[model samples]
Target: MAKKKFPLAHVYRLLEPGPVVLVTTAHAGRTNIMAMSWHMMIDFEPPIVGCVVSDRSHTFGILRKTKECVINIPTVDMVKKVVGIGSTSGRSVDKFKRFALTPGAASYVKAPLIEECYANLECTLIDTRGAARYNLFILKVHKAWVRPLGKIVRTIHHCGRGRFRVDGSMITVPSTIK
Candidate 1:
């Protein structure tokens, strides 16, 4: 087998995280949604999540000031809307209305959850030490919601360069931890 060099700029495609999530935030009565794929679980007991929200994004300022957000996991069925949300800014467009997405109130956070998503996690900002340098925001999940889907929920994962991968099958493997 032979291997070739891969571009550093496209490295993110190889390490795409779990899923592309729609992050909802509200500030001063204005709400916004930003599509995020650069998130990862940091802890299990309290459910810590580390996500990168670009400093230039509209949601970044709101998420920082309000210190809370809803991480909505959209399925493959809503791929087009997800891409649309990522392409446009809330400053000019009303995402909920433009994308025809329903906003549901969260129990803990001020941010509304996207009803079209398979799952939603209400989170509060826990740390911003890395935000200045890396745009990383550490969040603590205060509450969670999951729709009762009869079959497997196929979440979308961004592979960079406008490419995406959908959740496929599930396999049971022996584990000692659980």
Candidate 2:
């Protein structure tokens, strides 16, 4: 197959990382949920994560004030709700109430963990140096939870604009290789 150079605008679509997550934030009794796809793991032990939350987003303000959030890993079954929540601003609507998401108590953060997601990570905003320049936040995941049966909790990864890919197969690499 012949290859042609693509435009820079389409560059992000090529390196789409990990699954889309619903970030939940709370501050001064105001809680909001925003669907995000720009999160990545930065560490192994202690589990540090990096995520981008634009200044224009309402969740960003709450996150800055509270310095806490819950990273909710939704499954393929919740794709519709993920896209639906991403299309609107959480400031205008009570996303939890409007979307019928059950918010569960977290062990380390004030932000509530989303009960519907396959996995939930309680995060504390550890650094904000990149937030002003790149809309990125450095978080430390203090607590984590995953659904019991892996068979039922299949997650979705973002490919590009409005397109998502769900987990299809499983492969386990031998630890002895290391």
Candidate 3:
């Protein structure tokens, strides 16, 4: 096999670890949403998620004040809206209305769930040690909902430079770890 060397700059998105998600947050009577790709599950038993929200981002302040949010997993069909959400600052726009998304009241959090997404995880910010320096928020997912299975839904994964790859094909294998 022939190996080619490449710049280290583009390695971050070689394959994003998880699906792109829309984070919905509410603070002081204001609700906002933003597209987030830098997130991962840090724990399985209690469903802990770690994500980055830039300190300069509008959502950052809102999330900081509220200390809660909803992680909405959009389907591949909603890629356009996802990009649009990320393109504009929520500070100047009401994403739910601008993106034509419904705000469904969440049962566990003050943040509303994005109705169009296939899955929504109601999260509460549980840690802030790395927030000031890294803009990293550690969230505890207390409640989650997923669209019915067997619906042929796909998730979009960012591949850097405005390019994305849709999840395709399903495979199952026997495992005893569970």
For lDDT, the strongest prediction is 1
Model 3 CA RMSD to the hidden true structure, in angstroms:
1.3
Q: Of 1 and 2, which scores higher on lDDT?
A: 1
Instruction: Kindly report which residue stretches of model 1 are placed more than 4 angstroms away from their true locations once superposed.
Output: none
**Which of the two candidates, 1 or 3, achieves a greater lDDT against the reference?**
1
**CA lDDT of each prediction against the hidden true structure:** 0.93, 0.88, 0.92
Per-model TM-score on C-alpha atoms: 0.97, 0.94, 0.95
lDDT for model 1, on a 0 to 1 scale?
A: 0.93
Model 1, 51-92: lDDT tens per residue? Answer: 999999998898889999999999999999999999999999
**Backbone clashes in model 2, listed as residue pairs:** none
Best by TM-score: 1
Model 1 lDDT, residue 175, Cα: 91
Count of backbone clashes, every candidate in sequence: 0, 0, 0
Candidate 3 residue-wise lDDT at 72? 98
| Tens-digit per-residue lDDT, 85-163, candidate 2 | 8988877988888888899999888899999998999999999999999999999999999988655457788877788
lDDT of 1 at 25: 93
